[model samples]
Target: MTDLQIRATAAPAAPGTTARPGLLLLLVLTGQFMALLDVSIVNVAVPTIRTDLHASGAALQLVIAGYTIAYAVLLISGARLGARFGYSRLFQYGLVGFTAASLACGLAPNTGSLIGFRLLQGVGAALMVPQVMSLIQRTYTGAARARALGLYSAVIAGGMAIGQVLGGLLVSADLFGAGWRPVFLVNVPIGLALLAFSRRLLPVLPGDSSRRFDLVGLVVLAVALGLLVVPLVLGHELGWPVWAWVALAGSAAMFGLFGVVERRIAARGGQPLIPGRVLRAPGLVPAAGAIFLIMAGFAGFMFAFALHQQAGLGHSALRAGLLSGPVAVGFGLSSLHWQRLPQRLHLPLPMLALAVVAPAYLVFGVILRGGAEIGFGAEAVLTTAGLAAGCAYSPLFARALSRVDPADAADGSGVVVTVIQVGQVVGVALLGTVFLGEVSFPAPARTSGHALLVTSAAIALAFAAAAAFALRTRRAAG
Candidate 1:
């Protein structure tokens, strides 16, 4: 064989004499479970937190927004950090940081402190989450990779479902009269267990010799995201102050500057924080737009539903959580048939399924508003949303990834994930703002149930628009 061919053949596979797909799945799933669970676990605790900390609407918003903003900002940087220091090392350090931050959150005496600790917790999560996907990428190949991704997606759906359930149970249990504290404290043991298991189970990947940290890019990205997201989250709560508008304007300019800096870095033979080429992909832009719309609508619907169940119906945390289980069930069931659907039908099949499912929320709102008490009966809406999500998520993801070059997988994935995060942030901010603003009208006359019905209708409309867009894209592509 030629020298180049020999070298290619001789490149070492990932370490450990034997690697099992099952073990790798276990390790990666555990990490993903922790990361995604933390995202929505706090939702059920929002009321208790407001009471305990004597926090305002804005404070509660911060408690959620702060963590997400920090998490999104650090994701790209964290991936690079893992590459430089070794994924195993970064993953271990992240576990330690996450556990400690969770403890700090549990101990926090006030909303401000809790928000601060949560931001740190998010930093740790950002460090850890990218490694899970990277590890999967490094460990598995071909058909095995596809199977692993399927399992990973299932775990994500299940974990999100369980997080809400667990959050509700912890808040309702009030073990030690801890109230909302246990919601955070529960992470400690899980984090420790993951750390121990991962040390033994995860295979170490070789570090790149040419890797260099992009400090300037990191700073610029952080500032740009903060400027954009912070104002969107807090602006309405603060009554859209003058400074908020300025911050929004500044975000646009900062993002432009970041683009310029990235181009310059690329020209200088350095990797930018985000490669410009990935953003230029035609499929990525539309795919991201669809993701953003879907996420925004979903977040808004869930937030409004949670508030309505508790405040309007006087449901316990556990009860509210149980009411949302149907969505999870639907998602789980639909995912089972997802791989088979595209092959049998077409690209629009899943989107059509989701379209049919979207109106269930509207029906739910009408029922609830018509004096139907919130209980397991609300499962109709949950089921519809879950089914829609299950059918839509994978197909959308596959379409996006199909357009990506094999060599650009990591960067493309990062961009997709970043857009997902951005979509989530925008959803929570915009929808929450609308719900809060609308509810304040006519004071006590506007019940949380009414507010929720309005929000649900709005969400349903948004999803309908998204479904239409997806259909259009399908036609164009065909």
Candidate 2:
């Protein structure tokens, strides 16, 4: 065995350690929940923040998109950092940074300060979020790992759901007459509590110190991702300017350059940000494609649906949030219980779940096209989509990493996490643009209906494409 492997084997829980596995799981998952909650929590507060700060439209967009942009760009590097330092150590550092940044965001005096603090928040999230998956991969085994992943999936869905609900609630309540500040400030107490418990509960797993940080690869990949994601995030809001199109074109070239650099690094017998061996793992590609598709479809649906209700139909933020509860309920239910299905059906289940998702979206599109109100049929369709999404999310995640060696866990985690963030950006940018373009500010109910119909069709197409990837994943697994 290599010297690094020797140290890794010795780095797990010491013989006399008292950390309970269950508490440790809770500790790490809570950290994940906090990271994800921040992403969506700010959405409902954007209007409030703009009004309170007298911010410009561009600044408001930055406040909304800055966190995501930084998080997407830095995630892989953060994963590599975990592999260089210890996972537990990096998680702690990230948590401290994230908590502090959240406080700064809540207390910002103006839009510029808030934007800077939001980017810092993303930096902390990039450092912290990737480690959640790496820790789960390294610490758990077999069925326990599967269950942990199930809970992780649930937290993901739950975080998105709760962020909307809680943000609306906090803003509406205006507690202490604080309109939008509580949304960011809420994390402070939760983060502080998690910090106090993390060091004691998390296992001290050592990373491979021999693997050098690939500085050149990091720079190339960061630029590539920045070019790709920033435009996708801000393009629609900025009315698809020439700079956005140019950035999109530039991203493709940068990605090509990044691939060349990774190959050269491998040729020289040095570590790349993502190892070539990990990229070649069976099932990883198809699983990743499916994951991208699933998230894209779901995120687009969520984005367009929110606008359809609030901007198009003149619904209140709180009511819109409540209306979307069925999706979260369905997702949380299926994600936690998918394991109980017959063992013989396991391999084909993700594809079947995705099959269900495609039709549900198609039906939803039809309903929206018909100018259907937010009634029983519409809610049912949303729930069905959520259930199928929940089913596909966990299994595809497992399939993607199942063949990855423990030594490559951080690399694998980084890739998956980055794909998710990118997928959400693409979904919102593409479908959101379509929706927004079809309607005007103060859009009539009829105009909103047409816009939603078009967005739903696009989202349905995305799900259909995802189902195809899921099929390929099934074949890959077989």
Return the lDDT, model 2, position 135.
81
List, residue by residue over 220-314, the lDDT tens digit for candidate 1.
98999898888788887788999989998999999999999999999999989887776675456665666667767766766666677776667
Model 1 lDDT on a 0 to 1 scale:
0.72
The residue ranges of model 2 lying beyond 4 angstroms of the native Cα positions read 1-18, 54-61, 237-239, 369-372
Which consecutive 10 residues in model 1 have the weakest lDDT in total? 1-10
Candidate 2 C-alpha lDDT tens digits along 192-300: 9999998688787876798699999989988987787677767767778999989989999999999999999999999898898888877788888988887777766
Report the number of clashing residue pairs per model.
0, 0
In model 2, residue pairs whose N, Cα or C atoms come closer than 3 Å (at least 3 residues apart or on different chains), thus clashing, are: none
Q: Which portions of model 1 show Cα errors greater than 4 Å?
A: 1-20, 375-377, 440-446, 468-478
TM-score of each: 0.90, 0.91
Please state every model's RMSD to the true fold in angstroms.
Answer: 4.8, 4.2
